[model samples]
Target: MVQSERAKMADGEWYACLDDDLGALRGVAADAVFEHNTLPPRQRGNLGPALRALLGGVGEGARIEAPFHCAYGFNIFLGPGTFLNAGCIILDTAPVRLGKGTLLGPNVQIYCAEHHKEAAGRQAGLEIARPVTIGDNACIGGSAVILGGVSIGEGAIVGAGALVTHDVAAHTTVVGNPARVVSRG
Candidate 1:
């Protein structure tokens, strides 16, 4: 059976990123993002209605500060009391789950898409997506980059400027490129 590009993407299979249907979906997400980004803080509150409606799930008291961006809002799920500071970007081509009370500092980037390595496939806009999961009460410092398929354990601390490419164990503090375990917090 032939699956839609989005279906393929959600199933973690290779898909065409430039597909028309996917483009329309992204456009819808962009509109919601626009509503969140343009509205004044006072008017916007934490998560605006449009943006909230667009997301897959947003738990009670969860707040996403504006100047935020995402490839598709529907793929993101935020737990209750989770706080995402300003300038956070999520490429939610796949599901991105942030557990309750998780805090992401400003300018944090979460990437869910991995492009094809071959030049021909890359030019064709081929790519695969993987889910990113951050456990409850975790703290991710500013400017950290969390790559796809990485699962951050509960209460884990990711240091600023760290590049996370693998799973981070619970209660561990990881710093530096490749995110080595510096301490067990």
Candidate 2:
């Protein structure tokens, strides 16, 4: 999996775009620290607009908590009425599609790219990308990491701390590292 210098340069460019999008997020993170001390969080008003401006395109009524991070806002796409709890991170180096009505619990990380495991390739900072797709109405529990090229089927429930490396069947529940289908929810 040897990669060219051009690929490395492209990855660096992607990183730069991410830096630009997250520039506002740095302030959002700072705001969260003080936001909790306020009398009412609702009184603070919905900050969804602020976040939407930061991401690629956040659909109507999508609520994303503070302290969220994404690489290259252009690489991410989220549907309407989706809720992402605090500490959600997306490395959308490729493309990440989140369907409508999806719920992402705290600490969920979706990564859309991976570096070559070969030591020489890694040394060059070369990488490759694969898109991640989470289907409609799916619920992903806290601390789950959805890796690249994974398609989590519609209405599937991914348990807490699951490291999903494969595609999940529709309308099922999966758990554990390299997640296994536990039941049909």
Candidate 3:
């Protein structure tokens, strides 16, 4: 039997993003996100439980500030001591892994999905997904955008508003659009 669109998506192959199964999954994720975002600040402690029910994995002491968003919550994995500041958005069309002690500043955006570069394919809603990995102790600054297939190395620091399109080396500091390494140790 041929593979389903969802199966192809999981395998990181090109697939239609508007498929019914994927839409249903997104609906479930949206509902969960809505509930999590709507909870009062006094009940912030309950956020972990809410995320645990939605995400692929949520390690101990991981905290995400309210108003977070994601395309598919189940594709996100957060490690121990990870903290995502307010307004972070993760388009987890594929797996998005944040390693232990990683810190994401406010409004950070991580996208694992990409639409076709050509107009015809885009019009058809064809898309592909790639996994994004942030290694242990990495710090991503406010408003940074990490695009699909990028891997941030352990202990790397991404400056505010960086647009990361390629892998960052361990212990490096990157800044600016199409992020360039400014320091390496």
Candidate 4:
């Protein structure tokens, strides 16, 4: 979890900040790219417009494929040569940064915002933000769900369907639920 004093401010206070308030200020800015479909296609290629529109503010060399979804565009920053495949959903209520050459497989879900688990907080429908960082050349496999405030180090490979809830070291191979490293860097 993020222990920095800057990360712990209340939601109301945070939403008042310029950087953190973009999602609320521009809710669904890419709606033109996200058209309603009774049954959305399972394959990729339907996401190009959405990706382009979302990354309009980021660097020019960044690449994001179709069949992806994100909560807000500003909260995500992609380095050059980064690629996200089909069925990727990023709840980027907080910052989600992918380093250069980072590759994400199909069905990858990266979440930077999490709701409180406490009974009172849950009932109140409160959520908090944390950052997710994927280092250079990391490969996240299909159907993995990465939780808040976790970092995948450089050259790490996360196996398919893994649920990563903690930090992964550089060049490690992590698989299964909660994602234990099978090979050390």
Instruction: Identify the runs in model 1 with alpha carbons over 4 angstroms from their true place.
Output: none
Query: How displaced is residue 123 in candidate 4, in Å?
Result: 2.9
Q: Pick the candidate with the highest TM-score.
A: 1
lDDT of 1: 0.96
In TM-score terms, candidate 1 sits at 0.98
* RMSD to the hidden true structure, all candidates: 0.7, 5.6, 1.1, 5.9
Q: How would you encode candidate 1's per-residue C-alpha lDDT over 12-106 as one tens digit per residue?
A: 99999999999999999899999999998999988988899999999999999989999989999999999999999999999999999999999
lDDT of 3 by residue, 1-185 (tens): 98888898899999999999989998988888887788886775636455669999988888888898999899999999999999999999899999999999999999998999999999988999999999999999999999999999999999999999999999999999989999997
Clash count, predicted structure 1:
0
Return the lDDT, model 2, position 8: 42
lDDT of each: 0.96, 0.73, 0.92, 0.72
For candidate 4, lDDT tens digit of each residue in 31-130?
Answer: 6236412124443233345445565344445555555677766668887778787678887767788988888999899987677667776565456777
Residue pairs in candidate 2 whose N, alpha carbon or C atoms collide under 3 angstroms: none
lDDT of 3 at 119: 97
Ranking by lDDT: 1, 3, 2, 4
Cα lDDT, model 3, residue 47: 67
Compare candidates 1 and 3 on TM-score and give the better one: 1
lDDT of 2 by residue, 133-184 (tens): 9999999999999998899999999999999999998899999988999998
Q: Could you estimate the TM-score for every candidate?
A: 0.98, 0.76, 0.97, 0.76
